[model samples]
Target chain A: MTDMSTRWKRTLCVALTGISIVTVAAASASAGEISVWVWDKAFNGDTMREAGEIYTKAHPETTFNVDDTASQDDIRAKLQTQLLAGSTEGLPDIVLIQDDIAQKYLQSFPGAFEPLSDSIDMSVFAPYKVAAATLDGKSYSVPFDSGVTGLFYRSDYLEEAGFTAADLENITWDRLVEIGQAVKEKTGKQLLDLDMNDTGVIRMMMQSAGEWYFNEDGSLHITDNAALKKALETYAKFYQADLVKPVSGWAEYTGAFTNGEVAVVPVGVWITATIKANADQSGKWAVAPIPRLDMEGSVNASNQGGSSWFLLSSSDNKEEAIDFFKTVWAGDQDFYQDILIKRGAVGSLLSAREGEAYKASDEFFGGAPVWQNFSTWLGQIPSVDYGTFTAEVDAAVAAQLPTIIQGGDIDAALQAINDQAQQQMQ
Target chain B: MNPALLRRGLVYALLSLAAFISVFPFYWMIIGATNASADIIRGKTTPGGALFANAATFFATVDAPRIFMNSAIIAVVGTALTLVVSSLAGYGFEMFRSRIREKLFALLLLLLSIPFAAMMVPLFVMFSQAKLVNTFVAAILPTVASIFIIFYFRQATKAFPSELRDAAKIDGLNEWQIFLYVYMPVMRSTYAAATIIVFMANWNNYLWPLIVLQTADNKTITLILSALTSAYTPDYGMLLFGTVLATLPTLVIFFLLQRRFVEGMLGAVK
Candidate 1:
């Protein structure tokens, strides 16, 4: 009986081993599908799917294995590990990386990303967005969205405060605070919402003034950077005037404005869909240019929360990736218009801005030709050197935000930021 | 007697309150799964009628069978190996104690203090050279020789009766045979507790698996759920539903083993 059992066990194990090898062989023999890694299922992933459908219609043989199952943090972890491990076999041919992180990947692992400047015309994108992807004159991204900041105000709430769209057109950050206080008093709604842990407002304010945390040479310029200090002071003024609703995280931030408890959201163009999500209030909203910083060089235009596509140098399908990006992302103006109308995605492709969708009015925002407005403002965004140390510095700035708003000394705060950022950047 | 009974009542009330506090998040998860995404984020604490819709979306989007299979393989293989190697070392050190082995065991405990983040880069380099990158083998191998499990097994081995091992030896059984037959069956609850722990740790593992599992085909449930949440306009109902699904296996395992693990108290006689 024991001998029979042994024979059966051995036979079973042998069959399973054979099955495994056969399956692996079959898998390897099949035609490879393009694997895409993206964050944000509803936004980027769905948009990619729409693009894939368009491409697949032309070439029926091409298949896509788009994986939107990993969040931003997961993508970072996965990409970093694969690069550090020196194994790029399983990496997707194309991956979506946030604009803020483009420089980090470019510098940390110098040959990991393929230079797209040779294939796609970098001048076709917004000069500033393209500049963020450049290292040593080799730009590496197919710029996807324009996070051009806009003041999404409730038209009803604004009208009640005796302010028109033209009133918001060329306003400074100080004027916005005064208007916020007046709006709060008149409508019982906070003019804007703020998160104590986030530096988004400060970032928006500084960048609107064409300034950054670092100088052109990548050195810390916190103390003497007039725009940054003024941005800080204006951020504090909103809190001191009690015209802001304090919230935490994305959900709370959105909830505050979406519930109509806050009159306006001073954020990126990407928030249009999120604002439009309240269908009942569609006609009540309008887009205005971002408030300018008090400093001399500050402009009314700045970018935030944009991402771009990079081709992996080590990918087996590098030529295919380059061809795919060039044909659809860089060349197809109609495809850009389709994505914009359907997904509210504002592409950086300059030629795409000449498409019919760019001229169309959005009924959701009171029939304003919002895209035309965005394109005009996109040019005014100040060209700043986004140093690789931005994340480290951003964390330092976020830590001091609560204290900075509570009437804390600006110089002491700057010293704290310098001390902490220097330690972490090491 | 009356005062003592009143005190016992007070203890039960507090215990009930603590249990309620611990279980509220799980309750919220289930409630969220039943509601629309918009309503849930609006802080709607009550359940709604969206459970079926959420379930449909989850099933449509995900490869449920494949993900659960991947999770099962890692947990099973990881659990079985961890128990065998760790228990042997534990028994060996306790039964056949030498000064060198004791010092080595002490050193292993100190090594545990070094954070996982510091070791990740070096470990990735080693795995890449061995051609184990992006494989289940890479994920399982690093955790198989877990010091925490070794420490646990050693602590449990103290309660292992010396008399049983001695009798087996007297009966002409070898050390291997004694360990296999006497120690294993006697320390069943210890194994049970370890299985629950290792399974939970392997199941909910995020950062390491995110780094190691390169292909979407090999990615696990946690990775999938995380990706879903990162979407610009995440469907919270679907996400909460997916999380509820991911959490069940560990919850079920703990529910079953926890009774045996707790009731079979360690050092009760000692």
Candidate 2:
């Protein structure tokens, strides 16, 4: 009995081992496809798949597997884990990382992304977009979307409140606050919906003047930075004067104005598709230049959120990935035109603005040249060095937001932010 | 006697209330699936006209059957293998309590406390070396030797009747025979509980599968739901619908196992 039982155990162990070897062999025979990782199936993933189709039509041998199955947060966690593990085996050939987290990866892992400046003409892309990806002057990333802010308002609502679109064009934050209050009183609709947790609006206001949470020397630039102070003070003014309808998240923020509870959505020009989604509100909508800060150097145009594509240095197929991006993303102007019409994506390729799509006017905006205006504003968005610690600093600022709204001392809050952000950055 | 009855009543009440509290999030999730994105965000409690609309959008956009198949294969294969391996180790640790193996088990317990983030990279590097990356086998292998399950089996095996094993040994039955026949049949409840726990964990597993599973055709439902939420302007109605579907497997397993697990746990305690 003992001898038979021992033989049975040995056979069971050997069988399991044999099965594993068989599974591994099956997985290795199929390996021609290049995998891609990116967030946003509707936005970036669909865009990449379209670009991939363009590539495969010419080169039938090449194929792409774009994994739009992970969220932005999930991709970050997964990518960071695999890369830190020094395991490039399962990593995607090309991954879409947000511009803010680009430096974090580049600096942490020195050999993670290939310098695409060698393969593609980095100059054809926006300078600020290039700046986000450049470390020690070797640029990475084929720049994707631009988050050029615009003041999209209901023209009908503004007219009812006895104001004009021209009144919003090139106005300062202080003047807009007064206008917002007056418009609210007249129209019984808030001027804008403000998400309590987000600091995007304030960051946009600060960056319009070409300042961030850091100095030109890359030191903390809060506390006494005039632009920062003005941005916060102006932000408080929106809430205190009841010029804003309070919101909690993206759904609520988009809901307020889309449902006509508010008059304006001063967000990135990327939101145009969403605004125009209500075809019933088409001619009623018009965009003004984004409001400027009440301080010097603040422009009517500032960026909010944007992302760029980076090629992995560890990829076996680097040349193909770079060539793929350059062909469709960097070179194809018609492709840009199509994406703009289809997805409301504004490409960072400066030459793309000169495409036929840019010249077209929409009946949706009452025959206004909305795309032309966006292209003009895209040029004026003040360039800022979104430093490596933007994520850490942003989290710190978000933590103190309730205090900032309650008229807390800007200096004290800045000091608190600097302390917490410094701790987190380390 | 009256005071004792009151204490027992209080205990049952408290346990029932705890179960209710644990279950409310799932109820809220179900309710959210029935409402529009607008109403869901407003914290609406009631169902709305949008369940069919939300469901239709989900079925249209997602390859649900393929995703479900991927999830099912991983969970079932993973749980079966985990049970076989972990139960052996558990039985081995209890029946053969020697100094060297006990010390090794202690070390494994310490290893369990180390966060997954720290070990993830090293494991990935090993998998990459073997060229096992992006395979379901890669996803299933590392978790099969779960220390938590090993610990669980060892504890439960303490209650295992040694007298039965002694009687079998006297009847000339070997260790392997005793384990397969006597131990396996006796520990049916333990196997059932472990199967549910391990199956649920593998089904809801996100980060590892997200990293290792490279292709959309190879993706699981959790990954799909997560991706749906990350869009520039995600359709929340569709996203919620996906989450409700993603959360169902774990909920189903929990409900099915709860009655038996409760009875089994009570019997073991008594």
Candidate 3:
């Protein structure tokens, strides 16, 4: 028994040492590889890979290594921890950041990201896209997808309610409520699905009027903002009229619309892929300009969610990375058309709108030039300064959504939001 | 019905409900792997015929062999190192006489109250200074000296017989020989229980490996599966298939040591 136990210990030690040596050997990254970190495998990952392949075709020495093995939340946590530690060893060459939270990182870790406007032409992309990443005089990111808002509705349901595509164009939120009632009365489908935890619809309404949760100097603007008040009132009207199918999470939210339990989905262009995934619903769907707030300055166009790529200052292959960005991301119009057709990615490049793919009609959306319409709204989206505290203010807003939808006073809720946001911002 | 019989039936019904609640997710996951993504989202509970198609998509998308190898290496090595170091500390604390023994052990337990989130940045800095970032060494090192595992072993060590140590000493065996030959064989059940616990924790570790491992090829199956679920249009069938594959190693480990695990949990010397 004693000899057997001693031999077992010896085997364990040998196995451990052998395994460690093999793993360490397998981990050595090659030189000239521009490693990128992205979240989505099908959307941003494949897009970046295709761009890298194009760049590598022209320049043989440089290659790309894109890792899409972390979720967006996981990537943020990893990036934030590494940056906080001031450790540049494991940091990627480039990372994808959402437009709303770009300012948070830029302010917290100055000089951590390379300012790209100095090298890449900022004028070539949409103004709002460039403006989101610009601080002081330099823009820090090359914009990828546009989250320009659209009113994706079931055409069969709307037609059954005696409505047309022209009826949805250039309407306000109140008019939408009326149209929703008619549709629900005739077709028996709910107007839309609303998740109380998400402040997306409210924010989209505010953005259409060129207002946000913050002032120009990054002060709380929740109270005394007419756009916000109107947006809240309109939000309450949906629940008051029983026109909403209450959902909770991302899966339920998307599932409600995809399963045809809801008639309309007011969201960003990024949802095009999710909607198009239900291929059997082709020609049953149609896209229109998202409805605006019934305020003086509001327009039919707004944005909900979008993300961009930021090059890190710790990159060893800076020249190769910038050139790759310029050649594929900024200058390749045909590349934009390819991503648009294949992945339903609506690129922020203004010139890409003139591509053949943008001109071609999609049969999935009733043969309406959906891509062209999205690009038009993409250019018209009013740019807002998403301050470093947008996430905090967003939480404050989400907290009051339940009350706001329950016929609570809009002004009282605004005051509550302002107080909560003011406390958090400090 | 008689009151005693009714009470027994009520207890069995409650146990059945608890069992169903615990077992339903695994059932749903298995059934989900056999259905299409759309059908899964539509809440289809019954099994379908999409298992082969889902497996094909999963295989095509993920480099399963490479990632599973990465996960296996980290989990196996980390578990071994933890058991060796922690069990030795457990034995020494219980066996040897020292002035600061209990004091030092208490201080180590106190460190457990400090959450991993608070120490993560500093830990990352230390690993980066050692130039081990992005390597499996960085992923496995911080987890090896788990304080909770040490505490567990010390409790289990309380049941170890002191007579064996005295007998080995009279026979002229050294301390190392006693620990290896007598103590180890007697405490085999304790080690089995620790193996299952440490293996599961290391296998499911996410945030640390996510922060340390940079490249795609160096990532683990847990990280890869998480990324797959966050896609705009996640294919539930393929994802469930990947999860079933990811869950197999842990299930196998538990089954192999199951009887010993139950005994070890009751008491090491029993």
Candidate 4:
């Protein structure tokens, strides 16, 4: 009995000592060091690193540590877990979150993120981008990229189908369906690739008409949303016309388009880099304004997946991190031009569109001023309040996609989406 | 041809087809590493002449040596510690039976049903309170007491003969000495099998380590590879090259331990 008691005491002492050692190590973190967490090393990560260099050039004592070791999903999980646990020891000074899901993070974990409008000028960014991270009249994000929608189609394939670039400009979804059917018949290829699990096209179509899954008061807007019903009807038309080649996940989705199995890819401007990487098809592709839904208020422009930089309130170097974002991200037009040319990252700064890089014509798209066109459309995209339940509603839409594609009733599908989203929101 | 020969040929053909299907993705990965990113995206199955370029790009972009070192240290240290602690506990539970200990062991099996995601928040809080966040100790500590490994060792320990313990006792060997010199030598095969399973688990561990390891310099290859794959314009050639390099350690470990690993499984069954 005495031996067991002594062993237990020794174990307790050792455990306490071990914890103290870890505490001492953690306490030795250096001052003036701001760490930023980003997911894509090629795009945002390297951009942030260059921004850090620019900042450090001016303030020699301050430094930046940018870690891009986690994927976006992984970073989201880590951040959500740490924030929910209320332990901020391992959180980075800054993180990049997608604009669509920003509301979820902002509303669920209030006061966890620092509102950047407190320090930076929010008016300098595109209004739609700023509106995404704004809540209760306080904006929390430094706007980064603009995922302005574009209808990237193969000029060669469209030409084979006897259509001009003018035919694609400012078109509606019904006109796009006719064009897609013509292209498929003439070229013996599918017009586009659609993933059943992705509701990106539907969301883009709805947002083009200034509608979302929720109304201004954050209530479900599914049953009577005319824009949504038209979008779903358009989505079903592609499958009925046999113009869409079904694919799964990012690789297969991109592969279908890249391998020339499909012609058109209606995606964000961010995919320009991916489309341009196949240099053999340099002049084969052209970008047009995205097709709007056939609705009362639909427009030619829309937005898709974009992201913004957020500062964590728990940051030890909060002031330095804010200054770094201000100096490099907001004020530097030349830096935006560099990332635009190098990484194809289109920044949301309205002034950046005036830079020489954004105005220049590209031989890749047969000398079309694609960047200039993208900048113009970026302005006209209608703003909508993407409520905290975009992901839940997106999943609900995806669940009904298979049934909808099989010629199921559009009203029934919307009802099903409403039911699923209602259950998930709870 | 004889009917038996025809049946044998059919069976062989089916086995070959199954093997090819099983190994195609690995073959595709190798071919992908040898091709340009554009070619891979185009779904080209044939090998191309871009292997050296892909390797150069991967090495240029990734801090390969540092990331591999971090993975090695965590997996090696975590595996060794887990083996010693879990094996000891397993042996104790099987040999020195008690009602409370048995109940505790049963409760542990039930605990295994709870997913890691459910307990991640509480575990993070505990490590944060200890101020061990971002340390290798934090990544290694929570995994060292893995209940699945404990259950594995416990079941294997049942196959350990009681006569060996009795004979060691008659030879005046203490419990600790018997555990070390007698039981350990006899259970070498069991240790070999557990080493592979535990090492693989530690090497591929993603979630907890991603949450714990904060700095880029401290990240493992798994996390780095995942980040690479999620790039807006992912370079498949460079990404697959990193995967081939990352897979080598596990392949080498399995190759070295396969003979004893097989015997260990047979012993457990017996």
In order of DockQ, best first, we have: 4, 3, 2, 1
Angstrom error at residue B119, model 4: 1.1
Regarding lDDT, does 2 or 3 come out ahead? 3
Cα deviation of B190, candidate 1, in Å: 0.9
Q: DockQ of each model against the real complex? A: 0.33, 0.35, 0.40, 0.51
True contacts kept of 4: 0.61
Query: Model 2 — TM-score against the truth?
Result: 0.89
Ranking by lDDT: 3, 4, 1, 2
Docking class of 4: medium
In model 2, pairs of residues that clash are A85-B121
Give the per-residue lDDT of model 2 (tens digit) for A387-413.
Answer: 778888888888887898888987888
The DockQ value obtained for model 1 is 0.33
Error of 4 at A417 (Å): 1.4
Q: Per-residue lDDT for A368 in model 2?
A: 78
**Per-prediction TM-score:** 0.93, 0.89, 0.95, 0.94
User: Which tens-of-lDDT digit does each residue in A1-426 have in candidate 1?
Assistant: 969756764665565554434321211112446678888767788778877777777767766767777888888887887788676756787899988878889999999999989878887788888988899999999898888888889988989988888988888989998888888888888889998888887888888877888887778988887888898888889889998889987777888888888888888899888888889988899999999976677888998879898888876666766777888888889988998988899888888778899999989899999999998888778767778898899999988898988999987888899889888888
Lowest summed lDDT across 10 adjacent residues in model 4 chain B is found at: B125-134
Chain A TM-scores, candidates in order: 0.92, 0.92, 0.94, 0.94
Give the Å shift of residue A260 in candidate 1. Answer: 1.3
Model 2 ranges with Cα > 4 A deviation = A1-21, A24-35, A58-63, B1-24, B34-53, B100-106, B267-270
